[model samples]
Target: MIRDYSQRLVVQEVAPRDGLQIEQKWVETDDKIALIDNLSACGFTRIEAGSFVSPKAIPALRDGDEVFHRIGRRPGVIYVALIPNVKGAERALAAHADELNLVMSASETHNRANMRMSCEQSLAGFGDIVRLVAGSGASLNATVATAFGCPFEGRIDEDRVASIVDTYREMGMQGITLADTTGMANPRQVARIVERVLGRIPAEALTLHFHNTRGLGLANVLAAYEAGARRFDASLGGLGGCPFAPGASGNICTEDLVAMCEELSIPTGIDLLKLIELSRTLPALVGHDVPGQVAKAGRNCDLHPVPAYVRTI
Candidate 1:
């Protein structure tokens, strides 16, 4: 059933921003730029390079300004930066980011802890941001963090998430990324939520962001894809997680996603082998082990024939 997608798959790399943000060690600016450069060569149309969050909150990505300024822009590759508020938006615009991603949590508890604002207040401020960036060449987007579930609040209601999405739509935003910040989603919930949200808004407007916390990240992606989700958020070497969500690993791996698409004859336009090669350099950069499976195991088509001598055993 997963192989039945008639639409082309869109994979958006979020390693530079979401992936690196949660790391304990610092990733150098040039290295981050090199990582972006590597992914750019892989035919990813949308790559989230960095974010504008404060240094105090996320010191690992403090060099966002430098990373943005240093990376050489590849033609046709959309380099997006996540912005938390107007200040972040201003910084992103100054850095010449191709797109600006704003975010707020669906649950009040998580929103207060992560963003320190109520849901209603954040939505009200989103309108102000929309007006502020009206003439900017950069595209404006808002990610609904913890749309699937929140660590602080436990299970999140679908209707509440739908309300937030409706608010985002009212802002005339072209894109909205629904994030599983705590990796609490399963296949059934993913399909149900994506189906309902996409019904209210266009499928093109919704992007699913899943964390591999419970080992259901890929399954959730499959569920959303079957429910008509086209774009997904992935990281090279599976490099990211919520600082708030304990034991949560990085995002869905880019190489694994590409391999799935390739095996299914879907047009992802990304080369998995090259992306896996790029993932090898990530461990030293982040000073930790990554969680991507395809980085360690070869694709299904990459299997070798069993030797006759081994078969005899």
Candidate 2:
């Protein structure tokens, strides 16, 4: 089968929430708002602005409400808030989040470790959240963490992932994300599962989230894209990981993904230069250098003048 590679891709920025959640240093609420404001102008249609979980659970995003309220909302940008349960969903709704993202692990062990609940219990809680957010003018996005593989369980079944997507669809969630929580997904596996999931859900309604723990993040992304997935989630400077998931590391970098898309002539509708500049600010925010590579390696078009000795030679 001939694969079409000319589709425009949606890059959803998850820096504010996912990127900073595990940072030990505190990023001021004002700085978070500033970052969002800057990103709002960079042509992203969706940005995961913050999470509404308890401060004790995720102290880095404790000021989520303030950040959401103060940031300038671009007209076309959908500001999203990650919610853990019904209470977080309520807070996200009250804070005027454009979209509420609910998460659960595909693996039972991972779910218990991450959410302290069984997969069934988490889905039951989501039932109440779906009812509460119904007709509230806010869209819901369901994320299946450890969808590709689990650190504790090693390999996950594709049938289990499909069943979870079915449950989310039955609950009236049109937006769904398959998260490579521990970065254990490879290109072939990603393509297979993505193709399988696309059989049950529309490609437009699905998003792929990948981590670079095993150095296959971008490869997995390419595989999914070939399998008809167009939307993806990436963090600035490759900053992200689950506190509860062992071996989980940084997400695929935003600028790196944009660079790859640019090289392949895939339209991402994002300003690569602006995204790079934004990524450069992460080192100071976290009090150390970030894991992203684009900031250090200039674009392919960047050229340096030849040295006098080299010219003579």
Candidate 3:
């Protein structure tokens, strides 16, 4: 397939929220703020800075309010906060979040497991959030989790996903994200689903969220991009996983994604070198090694010196 090298892709950095949420070690509020600020300086137009969920449910990001209020806001960057219900929406709005992301799994089984509620119940709650955020200048985005395939349900029907997308649009969502919650998506599946979603909404309004669980995250990304997806959600150092979904892994690594885009000549407007520098600091911050490859192996442009033995030979 012929690729467009001139295409510009929009990448939303989700490390501060998705990456830190599942961490056993609590990422300090100050550190989270600093991380967001640093990411803002890295030319990202959108960053999922934090989530305004229950402290008991996600204690790692319990400081969401403080993180949103204290972070240094950049002029063009939109700081996003994930909202689970009207209460979370209220908290996010009170903290002056630029965008509120609402999520619901497409699979009935997964939704019940992840949210402890049915899909209809989640939608009802979203309606309340929409009313609450109306006239508040904050945009709303609906995410369909497990859109590709579910861990418990196996293959998901495409018609079911389309119906969900239709509902999100009817509910006045400005943006929508199709999440591969457990990385069960393949390239063909990604292309097919992305094409169908784009038929319902413009590519600008759609974001593809993938996990690296089966090592197909980047492959699915390329397929989606080729099928007309322009926006993506990636976590730094490949940090993050679904606390509710079994066998889920980190997101497609921010540095690795940007590196691939750079090599393909696709414009992401993100500084790969800057992302690499930030990724290098993640292991110490999170208390473990990360899954990102570019940070460890360096970019393709990063060359090494010749060995003396090679010169002698």
Candidate 4:
């Protein structure tokens, strides 16, 4: 049963953009479209269709615009595209994305290595993207990468993240997402920083993006939820790793996260069984065992009726 006063948690499906970006074999455009359509059919209201980045940077996602154009858009569903710079933003707008997600790293070293720019330069570049999407009839979200900690520069300062969050709001961003790019977040840190961030920014506008590098993804998420964050960014099947961050693992598994939410009576509004089935297909496509637990062990509600002979025991 749904909780009477449960806060609605929005899951932004990041499989296409974050999930496939790390694959060795390029996922065919048709396959990508089918994945998006299948996810849409499963009642995912927000699907990140693709990213508009330099093919030189991420070769697997070279056809971002084509993917966005080919996807069948549902009335209430949002198709988000990751735009790295102004050029990428232009491409996303031309393809008619429902939302633009602009990303930047909080760690200066990671920022330089990842985007070839400093933290300040990245924020300045975001201003240009903000200008580009100001009148395009689409929502723009600013994602502060490495918000928790960075592999290149460990333990990012909370004040810096809060400063960026304040800056994003000043730039007219409707929402802000804190990305644990290297999966270094812990529950205690999540609660403490989120408590401070929420003091300035309203809880509804904040989203949490976690990675499972050290296997603390769900713990960090629960901490954030308790801190009043309602939006989450999850990749289907636990696919995706930061290209710039060495030793970083894939994203938080959608099925596992959904199962946790449902068990907690948090009202995530996702079908866990369908999500687990969707996760099974990913291991073969990507050629590895994803870190999702729900696919391995069925959800709590998945009970098999005992056979007549077994019932005698």
Candidate 5:
């Protein structure tokens, strides 16, 4: 296997949108803007700032419009908004989102549960959205949720995924994301699928979104990286998950992923110390502890003073 770990990785921070979507306590719109603005300063080129879904669906991010309009847009950063349909796409465009992320599940059951539409219906709707966004100057990204494995259907066929990728390319999508929504993917599976997708999708245009449900998020990232995938979606403090998918947990943590890349000598261009400081405030934001480790344990290079007793001894 070609194991090239030296290539730079691009991490898309999704804390404001994916990370806060499932929270029981609503993250104030002001805090969400602050979070996105702070993350913007951390060298992320892409940040999923919010989504335009119904407030009834994800009430926490209902203020997406306000947040998008108010946040300080960094000169080089791209602010992305997740959209499920033409309406959401319109709302995103109205908010002046830099990119529109459209998501549909590979599994029929998950699609029905999450999007309230079938795969065919989702694709049909995507065509409308593509037409709507045409000439709007906002790029589009089609995310295939549960591309690796499904909670209800299990083991999505690789060919099925490739067909979806091909459709997105044909539809003129600027980017595509394969999401392990329930964290069911392993390293071997990730590498295999990434290699196949890379055959069709360029590494820069492809993004991998993994969850830490089974504690293999970073492992999968490495696998995808080794297989020539450079872009990844990670949430701050490992917050957020698929509310419709059973056993789904928060996404791979941004700080942890960056730390791993830093240790391996892969440049992510993110400020690790600033990221950790931002991660430390998540518990208060959500009113609960988070799943990310590097934030709590500190980076590997963080050193503590020698114990007073040991020094005296």
Candidate 6:
């Protein structure tokens, strides 16, 4: 299917929260704040600043409160905080998150494994969370993880994903995200599922989160885009994974996605040079190399000078 390719895409940066959450090394609160502040100035209108989960679960992001409080907020940028339940929601609200992102896996086994609760219990808790955040002026976004496939359960039913979207919509969520939690999605499957989801929610309200585990992340993004998805979640330098979901790896890279968008002439309003520079800092912060490509490959416009021998030849 031919995609418009000219449409503007919303790239939601999730590095600080999703990227750092799984890192073994602890990122200092000051560095987190500085990174976020730099991201705020990079033309990102929405960024997942941090999460309010228990520190025992994700020690790397234990300083969510301080990171959120210390970061410089730009006028048009929206700072999002990931929350698991009502307690986390309350803490995120107190930290002044512009949006609250709630997550639940579509597969029952995955949900149990990740949250230690059944799918029904997670939805029930989200209902309470929705009520608690009402009138707080913060927008609510629900992410259905393992929407494409699950490690334990294998292929997830499309109807099950639709049902989860229905539940979130009933709970009054403003946005919904379909996450390929383990990078098991193919382009054909992504297009079909995205079409199914677009039937229930508008294109603007749906976000696609993909991982590059099997090297299909960008292909799935293109498929979803053709199927009417405009928003996407990507981590800087491809630094993210599910600590609960076994075999999960880093998320789709922000710099790589931006590079794809730039190549396609799709407007994302993000500076590729600045994003590449920011991605270069991850190795120092996490004490390891990152997985993104644009940082290493450079853009197509980055021309190299010819060798003198070659020029003479």
Output the number of the TM-score-best candidate.
3
The runs of at least 3 residues in candidate 2 whose Cα sits more than 4 Å from the true structure, single-residue gaps closed, are: 1-3, 242-249
Candidates in order, TM-scores: namely: 0.94, 0.97, 0.98, 0.93, 0.97, 0.97
Model 3: CA > 4 A from native: 242-248
Q: Which ten residues in a row have the lowest lDDT in candidate 6?
A: 241-250
Query: Better model by TM-score, 3 or 4?
Result: 3
Worst 10 residues of 2 by lDDT: 241-250
lDDT of each residue in 1-313, candidate 5, tens digit only:
5456778999999989898888899788889999999999989999999999999988988999999999999999999999989999999999999999999999999999889989999999999999999999999999999999998998999999999999999999999999999889999999999999999989999999999888899999998998899999999989886555445456999999999999999999999999999999999989988888999999888898997899677
- The lDDT for every candidate, in the order shown, is 0.87, 0.91, 0.92, 0.86, 0.93, 0.91
- Per-residue lDDT tens digits for candidate 6, residues 232-310, read 9999989886554445456999999999999999899999999899889889989988889889888889888888899
**Candidate 1's residue-wise lDDT over 1-313, tens digit each?**
2357667889999999888887888777889899889889988999999999899988988989889898878899999999888888889889999998988998789898888888778877778878878898878888998898888788998898998888888888889989998889999999999999988888878899998888898889889998889999999988886566566675888888888888777789888888888888888888888888888888887788888899778
Residue 64, model 3: Cα distance from true site in angstroms: 0.5
| Model 1 ranges with Cα > 4 A deviation | 1-3, 244-248, 305-308, 311-313
User: Rank order by lDDT, top first?
Assistant: 5, 3, 2, 6, 1, 4
Least accurate 10 contiguous residues by lDDT in model 4: 1-10
lDDT of prediction 5? 0.93
- Model 6 Cα displacement at 134 (Å)? 0.6
Supply candidate 6's per-residue lDDT for 85.
Answer: 90
Candidate 2: residue 117 Cα off by (Å):
0.7
TM-score of 6: 0.97
> Clash pairs of candidate 3?
none
Q: What is the C-alpha RMSD of each candidate to the true structure, in Å?
A: 1.9, 1.5, 1.3, 2.6, 1.5, 1.5
Q: Write model 4 residue lDDT over 103-167, tens digit each, in one string.
A: 88888888888788887888899889888888889998898989999887898999999998999
